[model samples]
Target: MKQKKPNILFIMTDQLRGDCLGIAGHPDVKTPYLDTLAAKGVLFSNAYSACPSCIPARAALHTGMLPEHHRRVGYQDGIAWRYEHTLAGELSRAGYYTQCVGKMHVHPLRNYLGFHNVELHDGYLHYARYGSVPYRESQHVADDYYYWLKEQKGISADPMESGLDCNSWVARPFPYEEKYHPTNWVTDRSIDFLRRRDPDQPFFLMASYLRPHPPFDAPAYYFDLYKDKKLTPPYVGDWEDTKLLKERGRIFDSLTGPEDEELIRQAQIGYYACITHLDHQIGRLLMALTEHELQNDTMIFFTADHGEELCDHHHFRKSLPYQGSIHIPLIISGNPELTGFAPHSVCDEVTELCDIMPTLLDIAGADIPDRVDGKSLLAFADGEGREYLHGEHSYGELSNHYIVTKKDKFCWFSTSGTEHYFVLEEDPHELHDRIEDPACRERIAYLRNCLIRELTGRPEGFTDGTSLIAGREYPVYLAEK
Candidate 1:
């Protein structure tokens, strides 16, 4: 008999910081399911997102390319990987039934990139006129947290009224409805899909969860989970200190002033709750798999698009290159035969979002394109992951870039000409800035110069290639407009 191909369950959560998981050594949060998952599978201890935002980060995961190559660029802009062959497309070609349920974050909200079977349950908050195109058109019909404020909560507070004080885009809450809460609804749909899936041929199912992201709202019960847990976070940094930062670092300053601590604590609480909620859903999905007897043959991989700030360094959201935002959990469970080399192993090697595609393809016995920027770690099952991981974010008016090596980190501000250097071994929180420290000037120079060369060498003015189709597809909506 021929060797059986393994099915893959790729689970992703939005804005879940690295320390949020119990397996990741988080002190407060309760993540029994994830902890159990990590115990059975290999956990990439230092897996980081290539970019800190949604579209670009997710784009990298699906396409096996970098943001510089994909050209999806920012939040508002969407990169069309319509032309490249995605992991889904590759698996589909290899006779696997690829299905995507819940937030894929594909642009136009209608264009199906590669997965022939797709159901867009929810996605990031879209503020444009295209808002009408999301799962819910008006906030009236759906009650996201924002909606809860306007209706159920009867809170008429705007960003300023709510004591957000700053002009930050993330200050204000949005409408919310428990009925459409993406996490719950998404899992509900996924369970339905798994229940109805035919078990004959191998299947590739990605049940992406959009939680622990923002609006920090879940069912009231979830919020109550962390009510008693003391809000203990990593060392909080001085926001007013931005010597190397080019701009005012509006986000940094946003963490100061009254109500800041409370707001941040609440956000943390909500974020933790969101995480636990997702874990419960994971348990459900795994149970369904077990019930269907798909657990043995399926290769389950759990990760996230990027991590949330969760008040880390006084930052409320992603878009920063800090370890808090970039580092995410990567757990691969089941398929004990394949896990032999890395069974229950915790690899601290640096890996990027781009590596996910090639890894999936290699395991599925599909052809991985040579143009992919990420290397497959399947080879490292017995070896080790890379020593460095790169991440960048050029969204909004700020241009922040980072390169993380085994021992050192180099950060650059495009507008300020200011550079940041931190020896990761000594300064884990990245609180101490050694940009001007002469002792490590050579190391900084070496890393900065290397990163500059990499950034400059990217195919400027064009997005990276995807595995979906043959050529690259540029942004048609905003670029044309």
Candidate 2:
């Protein structure tokens, strides 16, 4: 008999940083559930987002192509990009039940962007105020919690705010709610799908969670978990001095001040608290999986769309390619017999978000298409090596590009027209910018050339490698096909 094709359960979070989880060696943040998941699976220590914002990142994940190639470069209007292919399309083609619950972020077609069915709950909110859809009104955010919040006295709240109560940790506007929380809804639906699913046929379920993003708010109890505990904020370098600063007119800047370390500290606390809240929900999902005896047959992956600034570099939002804005956690959990093939392994190689599609295809015994610009992690997890990885962020707020190897990293700000170079092993915090270093200039040029190549989809020695972000237009490679 042929080997059984594993069910694919991709649990993707939004705006979660790489260091937010305990499995990533964070000293403070509590992520016991994720740590447990990591123990049973492979952890990619150097996993980077393909694009640092929501829409572009989601596009990359679905298409297995870079942001520029897939088009949906920014969260603007309709489905602007003519996608080559998507994992959902592939899995559906292979006769798998491809289902997407929660945010898939594809525009034009609201239902089933290649998936057989999609329970879309607040995906790519292009119309609502502050990028928020009416989570409560849509029956996506949880009605009981909204009622409870409205009934609470001495809290001083707004009904509009009550409607906005989706779970997230990044400091902003609302608090986490379990009833209508995106994580809870997505997980609940996933569990339901699993229970009702045809056991004979394999399933491909993408459970997307919208939390640990912004408007950092969770249940007051989760806040209490870190209320007394001190949370460390990201190091604030000479933010004003560096051109690498966030694009001018960024929103979160008004919330911070020169001597507002305590304020920043509170913000960090709120952020981590939100992450912990999401982790708790993840624990619930995992428990359900085990209770249903679905853990072994399911190849589960936990990762995020992108990282939030969380007051890093004096910026609070995402859409930048800095480590704080691009690096994210990637944990793959599944059968111990298969995981034992490389037990408790860590792959430090640079891998892009696009790589996820190929990996999933490999796991499902499907052939990977040629247009996808990523590689499978089969070798990397088994202690093999990979070359450089790249990420893109063309959101209006931040124009950024990045490429990384295990040792060196180069980040560019297309909005500011500045380049940053850092040796990761030497200065992990990226405190020192080596772009101007005499010995590093040659390497910087090489990396910049590579960025142009990757972004333009041209070969290395192409002198006419144009840049849309930098105002030089050769043949504008439109994001759409």
Candidate 3:
């Protein structure tokens, strides 16, 4: 380490899949830089976002609390981030100079959350485009990247000129030069921070990228790299009725993917292209760290708020209890002496976004506050952590709860009595639903009871402390919160 306290370089991507990295043996996507980072540090292979969406998952990251405590169970905009203590806040109190240079996704578009300073750039929010929202508070106005884009192009230039839906399965090449892309801009601002940072105090810099999330606009070069190739096929559970696929994917922004194989392939091509683009941009950031001679001293951590379904199991977006939506890539690369684990280690611990704050706080030797409900991975390196993870999302009819372990998974829809079970070790793609299998009877019942226990005494009334309930109304946020 360079000083008594190591500088922190925390990088986050929006809606990136856990299996998108080359290091993870992904057959289609190319992420050389992330692979290298994972090889150099401990990779939490089972890392997840308990509430797999932007807003709720981020609440876990900022506060080290689960969805129940954070009160953000799903995607909802314009709600206040009412937490007093935050990862950045506590780190700032620990004498680290904190700076966030990308998406915060908190209310008001400019809520610092505890960072000493922030360079805001939350991507196309439907709430901000409304005429009722004030100009000063709107995303276009508050976003530094938007202002920079206008300066580079004409004042009238917009990222939305491509005419792509933000959450659509549609694919397209980026019209603008790579220099003007949001991913590159995030790295540019991050590199700028390294130069402008105070030399004396240790720093915490979060380079948050908003790519691989949507508009499917990778630069033409990245897009072209995979356009002609045959990519891995998107998965569909055996229980799904194939005849209704077209109906499920009829709309532009359908949650379930298209029936056409070519369109599904195009979506994969575009999504993988974005991952390679983000990976190369990350290479630039890594070079900057080395150029500044900070590579050895700075503790570099990388993760995403949530994973993209990318047409997996016929789903196209997040906020579902599926592996593609909740499984996130988590890597912490630094001095092994400080991290208490061997380099290039892979952990199977069921870690979550909630664990990030405590891990970072523990790394800085700061106090882990009582409000934190997460355990440190540095401690988990010694073979400790929960045996399984409990995840959920409040997506109306699709609102559900699940329990995932290294061996298997069990999911139950809240509003409906529907259930699904997967023996992940034997069927990693979840091609076979084992919910009704006599072989999986005992395991499913155990996991169902686990979910019931987890949901006991909740405002949603998902359980009665003994049995799992169906047809319960699930709210995006707890009423008490």
Candidate No. with top TM-score: 3
Q: How does model 3 fare in lDDT?
A: 0.89
How close is each model in CA RMSD to the real structure?
6.9, 5.1, 1.3
Instruction: Give TM per candidate.
Output: 0.82, 0.83, 0.98
Candidate 2 lDDT by residue in tens digits, 325-405? 778898888875543335577778787788889888887778899998777777565656566766655543345668888
Better candidate by TM-score, 1 or 2: 2
Residue 274 of model 1: what lDDT? 72
Candidate 3: list runs displaced more than 4 Å.
Answer: 242-244
Better of 2 and 3 by lDDT: 3
- Residue 400's C-alpha lDDT in candidate 3? 87
- Estimate every model's Cα lDDT from 0 to 1: 0.67, 0.68, 0.89
Off by over 4 Å in 1: 1-3, 127-180, 238-259, 458-481
Q: Lowest summed-lDDT stretch of 10 residues in model 1?
A: 462-471
Candidates sorted by lDDT, best first: 3, 2, 1
* Model 3: residue 448 alpha-carbon error in angstroms: 0.9
Highest lDDT, which number?
3
